[model samples]
Target chain A: MKNNQGMSIIVKTVTRVSVWLMVLYAWYIILHGHLTPGGGFGGGVIFAIAMLNVLLAYGSEFTEKWLKIRLLHDIEAASILLFLIVGILGISVLGGFLTNFILKGKLYELISAGTIPIFNILIGIKVAMSLFLAVLILAKTNIENGGEV
Target chain B: MMPTEIWLIFIISICIVGSIVALELKDILSSIIAVGVVGLGIAVSFLILQAPDLAVVQFVFEIFAVIILVRAFLKKDYHKEEPSTINKVLVGVTLITLGAIFYLSLSVFKLLPPFGQPLFETAQYYVQNGATDTGAANLVSAIILDYRAYDTLGEVTVLFAAILGTLTILRIKKSKNSQEVTNEK
Candidate 1:
């Protein structure tokens, strides 16, 4: 029952050192989206790219152990629903659909942009999960063919 | 920063060369790499035009797009057939037409406002009043997530539809696969 999979040592070492750093940078990009150039979509894709890198270096087995594909699908669906709920709550609380209803914080403050940051987090999670699931399914396809893939 | 014209020239030249390299390279991987170079060149053009937001978006999009394309390529045969003469003729015609169109468009740029300067009233409003109106420092974020929040939601909905479509296709494949397994059993 020795099932060690994935690429050679060099790629694994590189991924080990770089992937977490990229994930952290992606979080920074998502959090500071209102104050910076990249927002949820871009940041989320970057985060997903890091996970894809892991899948590339370590194989689907490692990825499955880390994050089951079914869970990824659920996370993506739930995040989309959460996004809609956030919008509906805006209309309920402020009487305007998708209104920037959160109280304005001090300029340049972390909590200043109100709903934008929250939306950023939601969108980031949604996009990351969606991309990861897509990549995972595609990579794992042909697996049922006696695991020839 | 270099002069706008110089930046434009560098970007355009890189784009042309990259596109040609992508078209002419015999190796599929090299062609994809060349296409990536073209993508970077276009993103640089966006940055030169003072749209960092667009540049960042386009650059990240290009990366993922290339990844997906590469995956698709790996799933198939990499045939190296020479492009037909008709294709060469079409490329020549297209390039000439595009060159003529670009030359014509160069004159039109002078008639338009300077880069990053909003010409329309609404755009001007965003530039001048966005900070106070939306209470967000990044005007682009304020516009996309606040002022035009509904539009962004619609865009995200479209993305959801696309993802769902892909998932449905995959699920069908999985179902067919399971049926085959059961038949074997």
Candidate 2:
């Protein structure tokens, strides 16, 4: 008997492309968050969706290269550190904790929104990288343990 | 119809359906899947509630939970067992109780103001104050980092603790034979 549950190339390709589009769109949203409703977490998730799509479509071989699990994990760790350091800088410079008005730049620009944009970028990187690592680890470990539960 | 009301109803309905599905599934795998569906549905509902931050956090947590659960289940064996009449009645009662509690809670809390409104307003006020306050346009940053820095610090610490816990539990040890091979090489 033929199993109909197997993935098809067309479906996989469509999803993969859509996911990349979503990741790009998410970056656009996050970068312009000062003027719009989109923020770090939203963009991060969108990027993660694309990563997940790639994994689902091409399996482990694709993920090993594209996802770069170890590098992403390091990025996640570093981003968390960056977030902390940024917060500390804000507190030390502004004489209070996490205050970002210390270095307000031009409004509606990429560098505007004081510390918000930087924080957003850091959070976005951390979230996206962490999620990518989690997914990769889970997928690989699942294979070692057995098939999907 | 008001957007808020419509969203509220949507969230409530999703919750009800999700809970019922999660409770009623026979197999453990099926139940977990149902819960995963519930989680995603709730994450969408969080978006509708205008709590995008909460929604994102929920989305991430759900992904983590589902991955961990699936991995755990894969490592362990599972079986489908027949449900007895008592079990059915208990489940039904439990569902009804939970449903009633949720309905009452939502209905009772009419006109609950948005949580972040004050924070947003504070950021605006600070902006008007000029250089005295940080000039970040993102009000959330001002509040999160400046006004509530200690809280953020504590939260980060808690996150670190949690990560450490997860790593400890999840990390696998290399075999001595592998270690010897590596040493020889």
Candidate 3:
């Protein structure tokens, strides 16, 4: 059972190659959210899918080794707090909560959207961490119960 | 390409069929797959309606939901409980009630302004000014992150709370045997 934790070798190989591309794509969506249809939540889910791919291909051991649950929890908490701080900054400096305070550069260009990109990045991190933690907990509990939940 | 109106009707039919298949199927895995099809169909419809943001969200969420549900199913024996008479009656009554409500909602939706027409001034302003004001090309992103950021924050909090609730409900204590085994180790 230990040896048979994941799928076949072909799947493992494909996952190994696809993981990098998938992660890159997710980041692209999150960072370019101001211009594109995909936003932080969608990008974050894509990241979760990448994590899921690793877990599915090589088992939870590889996932735990690569990305620690402690790190994910920290990211989750810190991202949310940072998001709140960004909102508070708006209230203090911009006269409203979550106000667009940054300078609006030319449209369609990256880094032009005031706080939208920041929000996207923060949401991406928070959502990715939360989803990763959820999947990890599910997998761990399933294993603990002798694969019987 | 076929006219969008015709395509929409076809898609709606597919959604209806997929849902019925999902409901009737007893095999847990098959039912899950059918539900995924329904989700995908709905996502595609969102795309057709020019809501790329909604489509992306619907598509991504559907995939994750299917994957997680499959994982949960794998952990348990797929022994579907036989429906008792009371359960059957409850389902029947609920379905009928929902069917009536759904029909009425459809009629109400038809009464609304046609597509591409804004029913509110606020929406018109957002469409006209969101890009220049928020500096985001994507109006949805501008609205979510800048215009209604407070609302988005509340939504984010709700999501976190929901996840926390799931964790709390599903939590279990370590058995005595497991504790002893750990101690021995």
Candidate 4:
């Protein structure tokens, strides 16, 4: 059944083992963004790459079955809106746009930074969804225009 | 331990060689892989320069770039065509001009501060106070997400616009004429 579409069995096996690890690592980077080097944008790109690995290994039909393009589009827009709302909330509460309003916890702690981690997460979601959606649209369009996978 | 300048020079030299190989390669796939190697070299140089944040991003970005390029290549029929005489001349001229510009830029670098010494007053302030103010151990993250968040917001907006533009341009037209043609087929 898995042999009918997409790449060979070896590629599928490797992707299956690696994709989830990639996603988990991406989330780790986003969540630990404040304490680490990689932040939202970097983690988000990793997340999108993980999804792209799935798309490439299993074929578009398999990917579309689980990940709806419409849902991804909506989520991407919502993440941007949420990021803006976070900024506006900072303005309304702290009298400045994107102000660090929340309590600053202990240094080097997981929940130390007030709004940086939150912003990181929001930006992560936004970047991941937007990049994935753009690639998916382009791939779909290419297929429609009679290009091979 | 070897000096960072030595490491940087080594990595940058490797990157230059890799880029030259990428450009000169006839096979598209091999060229793409060579380009990926150049990106990896740049990431290493970033690490040597003490920019771990940029290094991580560059590493991951290199993977995505190579993957995307390979996918795009897979979609098109492979063609091995020699550069025409006009194109060869144009490329030679462009390279000469770029080399001249780069050589001229070397003189301008001397006017700037030496490596690892930032001239900006804001840099000192950010490095000194960023951790205490933002409570983030990483100063780079603190500066990007807290101190200068407006700049990041602008960058995100640009990304959003680019994505929107791609979607708009690539959206499949579902006009009546197209629908009729598909139906007829």
Candidate 5:
């Protein structure tokens, strides 16, 4: 029972606790993007970093066994498709591509900003999955090569 | 409170010093850490300049950059090989060219508008009516996600292409590895 796939227990425990918090913070950034400094790209990068932290702590082998890379690829593709669809839908509704079609509620509210939040969420997902997939592949390749270039 | 110019100058000097240290350091790891420090200085300067969004992105990006660099370094030797002898003539020529370029660019720099003042009216419009039009309190977000969404779409497409390229390259490597294994068997 080598069980040496990841780091020491202390690091694993800390990562397990912090990973969820990071995800929550990422969601906050994405959801409140219109009202905050960070928007889709920033939130998405934060989410990707959270996933990367998990991979680093758990090792690629354990992570791949648990997390399906195929599913991530599908989600990434779907998010991009949805983003494009949203843009096209604005053309049909408002005669402008990527227009703010939704009803913009009062300012400073959570649900205001008419399609901006939607875009934020979609972009966040796309970015997170894209980055995670890239890093996952890199980690897998490195492992296969036995840490050689 | 001290003027923003003083704060900017101080932070920029720190960044310059840190970069010089990073370049001069013998240990690769220490150099990487020095670069990280310079990035932190830049993030701080961004914050001082009232660009919290850029500061946040820079901060997180710096973390990722340092992590990736350190991880890659771990896979190989940490110590540098021998330092190559510098060519004094080449250095002199490079310095002279750089100075000439700087001298030529001074006129262009003078022609540029002063800081916090833009020659374009579009910026003024965005700053004034961004929140009212987009219903987003953060003007930066409003501009990015609402006003110039097409630009953001283009950026997302670029990210998608980069990821697609990475996966394709890695997948080809995997297939080659499998083929080699099968041939050996």
Candidate 6:
């Protein structure tokens, strides 16, 4: 069975709205992570689920085209690499690894911390992309393995 | 009488019951649905504990596990009755032991006890200084990637191992493919 089918117009609309809302909420959580409870991992996964919803509603091909697997792969790799580089640079410049305040800015602004926001975005992208890959692999396996899924 | 506490209790009860249903359900599909309920419960519990980072990880892994399990179970036969008595007994004993442990732990350990002061104090110290020092508002993020960077790296590696193992085992190999065809005798 297709992931998205036999849905009333209302259900489809609700799903679409919720998916976007989740994406927005994920960002909210990540941006306010320092001041609030949620952080990079939390927000990242929520965003990933939101993406998954889109894939389920449309199709894998459309979702992949929208996200572009190549771009997703690059984002996934870049994010992990960025995380590591930030730590290494921190150790070199501030005598500790992953130190964000080495070149601190205003606390509340977008670019306040030298690397917190950057790390947040990187973590978010890495998590979402890896999860997307996992879902893709699972779907492909289900089809290739010849199951009712 | 606080509203949040009431809501929390209800959520916990739902989780416990949902897990029981997952363990007991005869239909595998329903069992999977119950597992999703259990995951939702854990995520809510994480939110209440002020660990949104953990909650997201829980949610993502929960969905991944359930989907994989469902897919794998789809091609397999489950019409035969399972020897469920042993499973039930094991689950019962485990739950009782956990409950006992939780009761004893919470009753004996005070949150702000002298011995616990240092632990919490350090956490607070990080919460305060972490933002300025790490320039990250999320103190948990600072603690995870800055204070415990090595640990986080180790965890990521562990996750990678688990995914690798799953993919390797689930893949249909040539030898197994031939055996499935000829071994029906």
**Model 2 chain A poorest ten-residue lDDT run:** A140-149
Candidate 6 on B1-185: residue-level lDDT in tens?
Answer: 56766777899899989989887778888888798988989888878766776776787768866765674465434532365656678878999999999998995666555421355456767866877776766677767756776676566556545645655654546346534544664
State which candidate has the highest DockQ: 3
> Each prediction's Cα lDDT score?
0.82, 0.64, 0.84, 0.84, 0.85, 0.68
DockQ class, candidate 5 = medium
Q: Pick the candidate with the highest TM-score.
A: 5
Interface RMSD of each: 3.9, 5.9, 3.2, 4.0, 3.2, 5.1
Q: How many backbone clashes does candidate 3 have?
A: 0
**Candidate 2, B55: how far from true, in Å?**
5.3
The native-contact fraction of candidate 2 is 0.22
Q: What lDDT does candidate 6 reach at residue A80?
A: 73
Tens-digit lDDT string for candidate 2 (B1-185): 67766877887787788788777777777777778888888888878777666676677668757765764464434645466557678878998999999998996666666543443464456566543354445555445545565675576556556655555444454234334554776
Which residue ranges in model 1 land beyond 4 Å of their true spot? A1-4, A142-149, B75-118, B175-185
**Residue pairs whose backbone atoms clash in candidate 5:** none
How accurate locally is residue A106 in candidate 3, as Cα lDDT from 0 to 100? 93
For each candidate, report its DockQ versus the true two-chain complex: 0.44, 0.22, 0.55, 0.53, 0.54, 0.25
lDDT per residue as tens, model 4, A1-149: 23227898899999999999999999999999999899998999999999998888888778888898788888888887887899999988999999999999999999989999999998999989988877665555443343221
lDDT-best of 3 and 4: 4
Please give the range of 10 consecutive residues that has the lowest summed lDDT in model 3 chain B: B169-178
Query: Candidates 1 and 6: which is better by lDDT?
Result: 1
Better of 2 and 5 by TM-score: 5
